[model samples]
Target: MLGKLKDLLFSASEADARAADHDDVAVAAAAVMVETATLDGTFDEDERASILGLLQRRFQLSDADARELLAEAEAEQQDTNELYAFTRAIKDHFDHDQRVEMVEMLWEVVYADGVAHDFETNLMRRVCGLLYVEDAESGAARKRVLDRLGLSS
Candidate 1:
C-alpha cells in the first residue's frame, strides 16, 4: 500500500508539471499584459488588481492560480525578445473575436490608470501586429475599450 501511494504521488507530481507546461502560453500572455499595464513604471494597485481579475475571469483560475500564472508570466516577459511567443499561442487557441477582445482588454489595461503613456500605446500597437490583428480592428478594439471605460478616444 505504501508503494502504491508513493507511485500515485509521483504520478500526480508529473501531471502537475505537465499541466504547468501546458499553461505556459497563458502565463506568458498574462505577463505581457501585466508588463504593458506597467509600462509607465507605475504598477498601481488598481491596475494590478484589474489584471488579476481579468486573468481570473478569462482563464477560470482561482486567485492563487492566477497569481502563480502571473508570476511565471512576469519571469517570461523579462527575457522575451518579441511578442510572438505569446501571441502565436493565442492566435492558435483563440478565435478571431477572442483575439480582438484581447486587444480591447489590453487597451482597457492601458487606460485603467486614467492615462495612456507613449510606451503603452506603442506596445499595444506592436502586440496587435504580432497577434495578426489588422490596424482597423485594433483601432476598433481601442475605441470599444474607450467606450466601455467611458473615456474619450
Candidate 2:
C-alpha cells in the first residue's frame, strides 16, 4: 500500500515538474478554471470572461496574454480527463494561500451565472482536497467571492 502511494506521488511529482515552466503554469491554472466553468455542461460568456479576468488579475498578464492562455487551456482541457494533473502542477508551485485563492477564483466562476450547479460545487470540493486546502479555508474563500459579488449563501 505504501509503495503504491509512493509511486503515485512520485509520478504526480514528475508530471508536475515537467509542466512547471511559466507558460505551462498559466495553461494549467487556466485549465482548472475551464474545468470549473464547464462543470455544469453550460459554459457561457460570463464564465469565460470571469476566467479571463481572474487570470489577468492573478498573473498580471496583458489582455492578449490572458486570451492566449485561455485558448490554450480550453484546448488542453478538452484533451484532459481528471484535474489531478492541473492540481498537481498547482500544488508544486503555489503555496497554501495561492491554492486558497484558486479556490476562490473557482467559486467566482461557479457563481458567474448567478447560480451554482451541483457539479460545480462538487468539483470545488474535490479540487480543494487535491490542493490540500482545508475545508474551513475553502469555505472562507467561497464567502469572500460571494461577498465580492454581492451575493449571500
Lowest lDDT sum, 10 consecutive residues, model 1, at 20-29
Superposition error at 20 for model 1 (Å): 5.4
User: Pairing residues by index, what is the TM-score of model 1?
Assistant: 0.80
lDDT of 2 by residue, 1-153 (tens): 999999999999988876566567778889999999998998999999999999999989999989999999999999978699988988878888888988899899999999999999999999999999999999998999999999889
Question: Which is the leading candidate under TM-score?
Answer: 2
lDDT of 1: 0.83
Q: What are the Cα lDDT values of the candidates? A: 0.83, 0.90
TM-score of 2: 0.86
> Runs in model 1 with CA error above 4 Å?
1-22
Residue 5 in candidate 1, Cα distance off native in Å: 20
Tens-digit lDDT track of model 1 for 18-42: 7775586577668778878778998
